[model samples]
Structure formats: C-alpha cells, structure tokens
Target: MDVQQPLALLGGLSPAQFMRRHWHKKPLLVRQAIPGFKPTVGRAALFELAGREEVESRFIQHKEGQWLLRHGPLARRSLPSLTTPEWTVLVQGVDLHDDATHALMQQFRFVPEARLDDLMISFASDGGGVGPHFDSYDVFLLQAHGKRRWRIGRQKNLALREGLPLKILASFEPEEEYVLEPGDMLYLPPRWAHDGIAEGACMTYSIGFRSPNRAGLAHEVLLRLADAAVDEEASPIYRDPGQQAVAGPGAIPAELQDFARQAVQHALQQPLALECALGEALTEPKPNVWFEPAEAAGMLESVVLDRRTCMMYDDQHVFINGESYLASGPDAALMRRLADERRLMPGDLAKASDDALELLSSWCESGWAHAGLSG
Candidate 1:
C-alpha cells in the first residue's frame, strides 16, 4: 500500500498520516470505511461455520435483566430463533474458513502482518450486545449489515460487575454515542471501554491486533532461548568443594542464586538469540490452527502462500510455522518478497538459486504454499 496516498478505509487519512495522528492513541470513526460493503458471508453461512469443531464460537444473550454465555460448536437447533430478541452468535477467526474473508483482511495489510490478527464476525438479533466491555487489544468494528447503536467512553476505573458470566463494566458512563449503519466503522484503542447494541438484526466484522504483554513476551522468548541453549551448551551440574550447610534449610543457597543469575546472563549473551526468538514467536500460528500436507505440486512456475501460512523474516533468518532458516544473498531478498507480498511472480524467481527453488518446492509439497498460482 502507498502510505502517503489517501485511503477511504482511514477516512481519507493516508496510512502515514493516520498512524502519526491516531493509531493506538484514540478512536477513529470512519463514516464509510468500506463503501457499499456487502457481506461475503451471510447469516446462514456463518452459522454453518460455527458448527465446525475447529471454529471457535460463542453465544451471548441478555434476557429479562440477565446475561448468559455459552461456548460452541453450536448446532443450528441450539441457537435462538431469528425473531428472538437480545441474542448474538460470534464466530472467531472467520478469515481462516473463508477465502473472501481472508481477502477482506488483506486490505488492512498496511499494518505489519506480525501484529495483524484475524477478523471475527458477530451476528446479532435486536437488542443484542456483549455488554460494556474493554478489550486488551486494539480493534476495528465494521458494521457489515443492518444497524448498531454504540456508546463509548474513556473510562479510568476498569471495574467489572459482580457474578456476571462476561466481563461487563459495573458503572458505564458513556460520553458519546452513535448509531452505525452498514459500511460504518469504529476503531478503538486497547482498554477503551465501549458497547455496541444491535438496533436490529446486524452483522459486524472486528479486525483485531495482537498485543503481547511484556511478561508473556519474556516467557516466550526465554523458552525459545532455552531450546537454543540446550543445543549449544551442555554444562555439568554444580558441586561445591568447600562444605557449607545453611541454618535455614528452606532457603536457597548463595551458590545456587549466583548460578541462576549467570545462566540468565549466558542465555541473553547468545548471539542473535533474541532476534530469532521474536521472529519465530510472531510467525507462530494460533494453537487451533492446522495445515494439511500437500501432495507434490509438480513443475512449479510461481507460488503463493496458503492463507493459513504464517511467514516472516529478519535480517539474518526467515521464520515460518515455529521454524527458522538462515537466509542471505539474493535468495534472502526473494524469500522476503514472498513474505511481504505473499506471492511470487515468475520473474521474481528467475534468478533464485537451485537450493532456494528446491526449498520452495518442499514448502509447496508441504501445503504451506501453492504452486503455479501466479496470474
């Protein structure tokens, strides 16, 4: 995407301008984020996806001053009738199941693929809502069908109501309100309290981002580092020559404390370990994701990554599906292009080395990518 060029998705704000002015700091309400947007997946089709075991789904209902929630592979019969008031069915990771949804998600590729998560579809009946809740990640709620009434606030007190199945705000004080029609969208920053209620039967598509917490990131990085450390170092267990007994048997020994600190230092000191860990972590697919191995894609001319494939690269390495490979020279450039654009033209691979071509063929056979997909 041309970051400097105006995009209707950003309300006529160029990507660079939008990022500079509003990204992660405030809300952006675009009147027509996608003009004349017709939903690719209809109500019946979405319900079909909700029935699949691999798809993550949820049902929420507010009936007679009570909030109720349920998990799914929900059968169609289990869902409330279309005429029923105050009920919703949310299907997560819709992009994984529908090709058009995946294509829809690509329009937001102005953001880094590493941070861009999946699109979720929420279908609701009249008066339906998940309640006043704040998310831990940024989100763009795009109204796909019918209408929704939204109330937003910059709340400081992040308290939840008692004995509720969902995390609902105890005292929601809305500062602004809007009724969104089809094609309208609202972007909210992380922890920005907001509520959306269906004015009638409506469908909304949520484009969300992945924000890794500091401690959680540290844990993942350390795990990756440990795997590297085990392969590179095989140190003997500690043994003290000078006999010393501690008065407090429960307390850890001073020698052990020093050992622990040194171990951490050694892990951090490994060359390029942190970079490798981060690349691998960012490209790792979600737990529920699975890929079917492809039979030989014979005589490939060009290729495209499967929608489910997660590929990324750094200065020294290319990472995919929790695996990493050293990449350099012209081959590195070729692979990086594949990661970024997600497709390679015949000309793009004209100069690739035999080693690189063989590797790509292996990827195609493994179902990570498709062969002869270039137009």
Candidate 2:
C-alpha cells in the first residue's frame, strides 16, 4: 500500500499520517470506517464456530448483579435465550475460519505483519458487555451490527475487581462516550480503559495487535536458537585439568559456569542465527491452528497463502509456519512480495527460479498455500 494515500478506513488520514499521529499515542474514532459494513459471520455461523472444539470461545452473562463466565466449546443449547439481556458470546480468531472475515482484517495491514494479531467477533444480547477493562495491546473495535454505546477514558487506576472471572476495572472513569452504528470504529492504545454496552442485540469486530513481552520473546527465540544449533558440530565439553578440588562439591564450579556461558555466546555468534530464530518464532502457527492436506500442485500459475499461514521475511531469509529458508537476490524480492500481499499473480510467478517454484509447490502440497488465485 502507498503510505501517503489517504484511506477512509483511517478516517481520511494516510497510513503514514495515522501511524505518526495516533498509533500507541492516543485514541482515534473513525465514523464509517467501513462504509455499509455488515457482519461477515452471522449469529448462527458464529455460534457454530463457538461449538467447534478447535475454536477458542467464551460465554459471559451479567444478570441480577451476578456475573458468570464459561469457556467453550459452548453448545447452542447451553447459551442463554436470545431475549436474555446482558449475555455475550465471544469467538476468537474469526479470521482463521472465514474468508470474508480474513479479508476484512487485511485492511489493517498498514501495520507490520509481526505486530498484527487475529480478529475476534463478539455477539451480544441487549445491554450486553464484557465490562470495563484495559488491554495490554492496541485494539480497533469496529461495530458490525446494531448499536453499541462506548465509554472511554485514560485510566490511571489499573486495579481490578476481586473474585471475578474477568479482569474488570474496579474504578472505571469515563471521559467520553459514543454510540456506534455499523461501520463505525474506535481505536484504543494499550492501557486505555473502555466499556462497550450493546444498545440492543449487537456484534462487534475487534482487530487486535500482538504485544509480545520481552521475557516471552526471549524464551521463544532462545529455544528456537538452541534447536537450530543442535544439528551443528558439537562444542567442546568442560575440562578442569589444571583445577584443584573445591571445598564444597555441591556448588557449581566457576570453570563450568564459564563453559556454559561460552556455549551460549557461541550459539548466538552464528551469522544470522538470531534473525532466523526470531523470524521462525514469529511465524509459528498458534497452538489451536491446523491445516488440511492437499494434493501436490505440480505447476503453479498463481498462488495464495492460506489464511491460517503466517509468512514473514528478513533481509536474509523467508519464514513461514515456523520454518525458515535462505533467500537472496530476485527470488528474495519475490518472496517478500508474497509475504506482503499474501498472494502471487501469474506474472509474478513467472519470475520464480526452479528452486523457488519447487518450494512453492511443496507448500501447496502441505496446504500452507493454494495453487491458484484466491477469490
């Protein structure tokens, strides 16, 4: 996308302008972000997805001053009556299951793919809401159906109510409010408290970004680095030919500690090792995601990545579904395009080398990508 091109989705701001002015800095409320928007997944379809064991879903109800929460797969029979006020069903990762929902999410690709997370759809009855709460990551809440009254504030008191299944704010202070109709959207940065209550029966689509914590990122990258190093030639074992016996055998030896440190440093020292590991980890499929096998695609006219497939690239490598491949020159450029656009046209595919074509064919066979143009 052209960064300088203004978009209705960003409320007439160019992507560059929006990112500079609002991202991680303040809230942005865009009226008619998607003109004439309708719910891509209907109520019945959403409930069907919630019933699937592979999908992550939650059922919440606030009734008579009592709150109830339940995890799914929640069968339709288990749900409250449609007339029941203050009841909600949240289905996570809707993009992974529906084509139109995935296409809706692609509009937000102005942000880097690494930070772009999944889209979640929440279906609710009259006056329903998940309560006032703040997210650790940024979110774009888009109204899909009916109307929702949203109260937002810059929360200073981050304390949560006790003995609750949800982390609801104990003191929710509202500074501004709006009633959103279909196609309206509100963007909130991390830690900005907000509450949305349904005016009637409604559905909201939440586009969330991933904010990987430092410790968690380190844990995953380090583990991948270790796994990558396992196939390499072995490093030397610790030796103490010149050392004297220690007074306490229970204590870790200083030489052995140095040896362990050196081993880690050696692993990190490999060229592009850190980058490869980080890329692979970021592209890794979520635990609940699975792909269907496909027949081998011998000749590719065009190809599109599976919606569930996560693909990314660096200067030196292309990463897809937790695996990495060395990439360079024109081939690398082509792969980068594929990652950015999630599809390759026939004209683009004609430039691929035999090796790249073979690799793409193998990906098609594995269901990571499709053999033809996606509709």
Candidate 3:
C-alpha cells in the first residue's frame, strides 16, 4: 500500500493520514468505504461456519424487551427462522475459513499484523443486537447488507448490568447515532461504547485489532521467558540449611519472594531472551487453530505461509507459530522478506543460506507453509 496515495476506504485520506488523525483517537464514518460492497460470505455460508466446531460463534435474541445470549456450534435447524425478529447469529474469525474474507482483511494491513486480529461477521434479523457494550480493542464496523442503526458514545460510566452473561452497559448514554447502509463503515477506538441494531435483516463485518492489556501481556511473556530459561539453565532449588522458625506458615516468606523476582530477572537478563519470548508470544496461533502435517515435500520454486500460520521477526530472531529461531546475515534478510511479503520466489530462496533453506523446507513439512504459486 502506498501511504502517500489516498484511499477510497478511508474516504480519500491516505492510510498514513487516517492513522495519524483518527486511529485510536476518534471515530470515522466513511460514506462508502467499499463502494457497492457485498458480503463475501452469504447468510447460509455464515450459518455453516457457525456450525463448525473449530469456529467461534454466538447467538443472541431480544424478545419482549429482554436480552438473551448463547454460545454456538449451532446447527441450521437450531437457529431461529429467517423470518424471526430480533435475533442475531455472529461468527468470529471468518477470515480463517474463507479466502474472500481473508483477502478483504488484507486490505487493512496498514495496521501491523500483530495488532490486526480477526474479521468477524454479525448477522441480524429485525431489531437484533447484542446490546450496548464497549470493546477493549479498536474496531471497524463495515455494513455489508441491509441497514443498521448505530448508537455510540464516549462512555464515562463503564459499569455493567449485573447478573447478565453479556457485559451490557447498565446506563447507556448514547451521544451520536447513524443508520449505516451497505458499503458504509464506522471506525471506533477502544472503550468507545456503541450499540448497533438492525433496521431489518442485516450483515456487518467487524475488523478488530488486539490491544493486549499490560498485565495480561506481561504474564504471557514471562511464562514464555521462563520456559526458555528452563531449557537454558538448570538452577539449583533453594535449600534452607539454617532453618528459622516462622511465626505464621500461611505467610509467604521474604526469601521465596526474592527467589521469584530473581528467577524473572535471570530470564530477562539472557541475551535476546525477552525479544524471543515477545515475538513468540505475539505470533502464537490461536488455541483452536490446527494444521495437518504435509505428507511429502513438493517443488519449492515459490512458497507462502499458510493462512493459519503466524510469522514475525525482530532484529535477532524470527518467530513462527509459537516457536522462535535465531537468524542472522543473508539468511535473516531472506526470512524477513518471507515474513513481510509472505511469499518467496525461486531466486529469493537461491540466495538463502543452507540453514534457512532447510528451515523453510521443515516449515513446509509441518504444514506451516506450502511450495507453489501463492494466492
């Protein structure tokens, strides 16, 4: 994508301009983000995805002014009739299941792939909605079919209604409203509360970004670091030779606390250990994602990483699907290109070191990559 060139998706603003002006700062309502947009996945196809065991989905219904929610692996028969009013079926990660959906997501690669999460589709009958709620991450809500009336606010009161499966705003104070038609889009920042209700039967595509909370992200990184540390060193267990009587057995000892801190410090101290752990954590595949191993190696004239595979690299390491490898020299450059472009030509691989070529082959064998013309 040329940052200098204006985009129809961002209402004639360049990706750089959109990122600088509206990203994470305010809302943007593009009149026709995708002109004459049609859903890549139809209603029937979305229902099929909701039925798949590996896909994440949800069913919500609002009847007689009451809100209800359900988890899915829902069958077509289980879903409410198309004529049913005030019901919705939402499927998460549609990009993972459909090629067209995946391609649609790629258009938004102006955002770093690490932050770019999944593309979800929400289908609704008349007046259907999940209720007024705020997300912890940024999102682009693109209307695909029919129309949706959206009520949004910069919610100051984040309290939720108690005793509900869904985290609905107890006191929703909508500051703005709009009726979005097909091809229209709304961009929202984290914690900008919004509620979208179907004017009639409608489909909306949500392009969401992951904003990992500081503490939760720190915990995951530390766990990965600890795993790497264990493989690198066999530290001795603490032995209390001069035992001191404890006043309370329930209390954690100061010595044990220090040992825990030291353990984390040691992991952080290792050269590139923190970087390795972070890259691995960011590139880790979703728990439900699984790939079948390749039966035999094929031609390697060109190669592309599988859509389900996650690949990323830093200055010293390349990470793919939760594993990390040290890379340097020309091999490092080659691997970085693979990570960026997600495809490598025959000539590109010809310049790779023996170690890098072997690694790419192994990735193919593991079903993380395939040898052929990339889509």
Candidate 4:
C-alpha cells in the first residue's frame, strides 16, 4: 500500500494527502467511492448473522411518530413488517464475518491498525434513522443500496436530551445536506454531528474507527502490565520499620505510598510494555467472538493463517489476538510479512525454519490460526 499513491477509495487523493488535509479535521464526500457497490450478504443472511451471539445487532423502528430500539438475537418474527417503511436492522462488525467486508476494510489500512475498528451495515426502510448523534471516533459512511439523505454540521452545543434511551442531540443544526445513492461515501471526523434518514429501502455501511478514552486505556494497559509483571516473578514484599510508632490507626504510612508508586512505575518501565499492552488491547476479541479449537491432524511443513485473525508486529514483538511473542531473525521477518499481507504464500511458508513451523503448528492447534497445504 503506497501512502502517496492516489486511490479512488480515498476520493482520488493519496492516503498521505487525505491524512494531511482531512483526517480528524473536516468532512469529505466522495461520489462513486465504490463503483457498482452492492451488499455482499442478502437480507436473510444478514438477519441470520444478527441472530448469532457473537455478532452485535440492533433493530430500530420509527412509525406513527414513535421511535423504538431493540437489541438482537432477534427472530425475523420480532422484526417490524418489511412492507412498511421506517424500520431498520443494523449489524456491527460485518468485517469480522464476511471476507468481502474484510477486504473492503483493508483499503483504510493507511490509518493505524489500532484505530481501524470494524465495519457496520445498516439495512433501513424509508425514513428509518437512529436519530441525530455524534461519534467519538472518525467514520466513513458508504451508501450500499437504495438512497439516504444525510444532514451534517460541526456541532458546537454538545447538549443531550435527558431521559432518552439514546444519547440523541437535544438541538441538531445542519449546515450541509446530501442525498447519497449507491457507492457514495461521506467521511466525517470525530464529534461532527450527522444524521442519516433513509429515503427508501436502504443499506449503509459505516467504517468506524476506534478512539479509546484515556482513563479506559490506562485501566486496560495497567492490568496487562500487572499481569506481565507478575509473570516475571518480581513480587517484592513491603517492609516497615519495627520501631515506628503510629499516632493513630487511620494514619497511612508515607513510605508505603512511595513504595506503591514505585511499584507502578517499575511495571511501566519494562521495555516496550506500553507497546505490548496496546497491541494486546487492540486484538482483544469482542465478547461475542469465539473460536473453535483446530483439530491437530499431523505436523505440516507450511500453513495459511485464518482470515479472522488480527496479527500485528512491532520491532521487538509480534501480537496475534491479544497474545505477544518475541520476534527475531527470519521468523520475525516472515511473521511481519504475514501480518501485513494477511496470508502466507507457499514461497513465504517455505522460508520458515523448523522452529517457526513448530510454533505455527501450535497456533493452528490452538485455533488462533489454520493449516493448509502449499498451493
């Protein structure tokens, strides 16, 4: 992927240009972003995916001046009448299930993998919408089918309506409007208020980015760092002076506070601890995701990794599905290539040494990856 090369996906701008000119700064509407774009999964198939426990889904119905929202595992019977307009079913993380959707998501890889979240597909009837709201992360809204009317603006007032089930903006002000047909896409940065209402039967694909809040990030990273520190067998006990006299039982010892702070600092001081934690955090499977254990048939000279797998690497380590492995030499190079390409060709697999092959075999057995004959 050449960051400087112009791409139709980025509205004829190179990724470098897009990043510099618009990313997290303004909005871009790309006409015919995906020429001849169509839904990869049919309505029934999408509904079936929504019924699965691992897929996050929701249904929204707006009718007779009333709005209703429901979480899914929804049976088709539970859905609003398709014959009537103003109903919708949204399935999140379509990229994790469909190969085509995953391929579509790769076009945005110029952004950091950590920020690249998942694709969500919304199937809506006439007038269906989730209401006006703002997202904390950037998003690319691609119209897949039918038509949708979008009104957008830079929102200054962040006030929300109280007592509503949804966090809808209390007062939405629109400065721009566009009616999108198939293949039209709108890119909006974080906090840009927008609302999309279906003009008729419609399907919209949202490529949403992740924006981890600071406190939430710290909590996850600290937990991971603590686990790694414990694994290192470095549990040092706190010591107190025997001769020290306490005026009150409620008085906290200053030395103990300093010791606790030093402990936290020490854990964070480990080389690349933050990087490792970040990789693990990004690859952590959603609650709905689960993997079946791969059956071990026999030792293989080579194998192909699973498409659902998220593999990434940095200078010192390789991360796959929240687990990190030390990276070095030819094996490291091969693993890094696999992460980038999302597949190991026969030629690449042939370069793997016995040690690397053994590790890959273990991964296959654990269902983190899959095995295949050289093609």
Sorted on TM-score, highest at the top, how do the candidates line up?
2, 1, 4, 3
Better of 1 and 4 by TM-score: 1
Cα lDDT tens digits, model 1, 9-67, are: 99999999888888889999999989999997999999999998999999999999999
- Pairs of residues clashing in candidate 1: none
- For 45-74, candidate 3 gives per-residue lDDT tens digits of 999999999999999998887778889898
What's the TM-score of each model vs. the native? Answer: 0.96, 0.98, 0.94, 0.94
Candidate 4, position 173, lDDT: 98
Flag regions of model 4 displaced more than 4 Å: 297-303
Q: How many residue pairs clash in each candidate?
A: 0, 0, 0, 0
Model 3 misplaced stretches (Cα beyond 4 Å)? 244-253, 373-375
Residues 1-375, candidate 4: write the lDDT tens digits: 789999888789999999999999999999998899888777788889888877889988766866777898778877877668888899999988987888888888899777888899999988889889999999999999999999999999999988766778999999999999999999999999999999988899999998999999999899999888888875888988553776787877888899999989998888899999988877887776667787773656456556567788889899988898888999999998878877776688779998887888788887777777432
Q: What is the C-alpha lDDT profile of model 2 across 1-375, one tens digit per residue?
A: 999999999999999999999999999999999999999999999999999999999999998998899999999999989998999999999999999999999999999999999999999999999999999999999999999999999999999999999999999999999999999999999999999999999999999999999999999999988887677876576788998877988998888899889888998999998999999999999999999989977678999999999999999999999999999998999999999999999999999999999999899989999997334
RMSD of each: 1.8, 1.7, 2.2, 1.9
For each candidate, the alpha-carbon lDDT, in order, equals 0.90, 0.95, 0.90, 0.86
Which ten contiguous residues of candidate 4 have the minimum total lDDT?
A: 297-306
Best by lDDT: 2
**Ordering by lDDT:** 2, 1, 3, 4
